[model samples]
Target: MQLENKVAVVTGASSGMGHAIVELFAREGAKVVAVARRKERLEELVASLADAPGEVAAYPGDVSSREVNEGMIDFAQKTFGGFDVLVNNAGIMDDMSPVGDATDEKYEQVMAVNVYGPLAAMRAAVNAFKASGTKGSIVNVASVGGMRSCAGAVYCASKAALISLTKNTAYMYMADGIRTNCIAPGGI
Candidate 1:
């Protein structure tokens, strides 16, 4: 779909892959709502992308929090009118450890940021897309850990669940003109 004049919400956009995606989307003429936990980093990114085809606004908040995710979407709609795309890219990888050595805290942290975070964002985006009556796309950044068992046990399991959620949501939302897809990146 043409990205010109479109509105995109990208989580974890302060740094890493999320930042790159946000920059590219803006260059492609999509007004991007850059969401991340670090307000300063997001501001820097926005400054660097000032000359891009489309504009960008930074929304700093933790993606793992349901209130934050909902608020971000609401802010984006108020700012851009409606939503067209969502990039569920916020994630955190815990220290490599076997299942036997994994701590409950580590597991919970990883799942909250990497798995539940994206799910919450997707729910918000779906509602916005339906309300806008526009064809929408959701791009989830999963990991090779999801497709294979090579990653640390807890991380792998979280990503695998994310993959499953992506596919299921894709199937369920196809009839609604909303497309959901995932990218499983390998090595980083």
Candidate 2:
């Protein structure tokens, strides 16, 4: 197993890319703490992974909250021993409105979840690794929209900010045994 004995935290674990990453990580032998907003769905996800090589534990909450972000790390440490990987995969898209047509609420909501959420989670993870002297891996899921301008104003700008954060984290923490990288997937 590529991640035998590793413990991971995956946000947005009830659907889409987050769910997929949790399944893949479990198959590769990394115990996972799945974070999402839907308690029932999160429970279902954990149940479905019952026979995987590793394990899955559900923690339902909104990733945009710093407490929720830090709580995931604490759950990993308390449940699976320690944290080694974090997949910052939770995100929301805007209404595809141009900046001129966008509302302040949409802009704020998208940025809060996309940028600040990941930032808070990664911060907690990095601090955990530093304190425990553990080498860690952080995978920030960005988008091609982040690099270009395909997804309208709020989403595009939020993703762009995510990409920049990923780069900065990589450079800032590489020597500390925490390697950060981003995946800017195109389309599906």
lDDT of each: 0.91, 0.94
User: How would you encode candidate 2's per-residue C-alpha lDDT over 1-188 as one tens digit per residue?
Assistant: 99899999999999988999999999999999999999999999999999999999999999889999999999999999999999999999999999899999999899989999999999999999999999999999999999999988999999999999999999999999899999999766
Kindly list the per-residue Cα lDDT of model 1 for residues 32-123, writing each as its tens digit.
99999999999999999999988899999998899988988898889998888999999988788989999999999999999999999999
Off by over 4 Å in 1: none
Whose TM-score is greatest here?
A: 2
Global local distance difference test of model 1: 0.91
Clashing pairs in 1: none
Q: Give the poorly placed runs of model 2, Cα more than 4 Å off.
A: none
Which candidate achieves the best lDDT against the true structure? Answer: 2
Query: Candidate 1 at residue 81, lDDT?
Result: 88
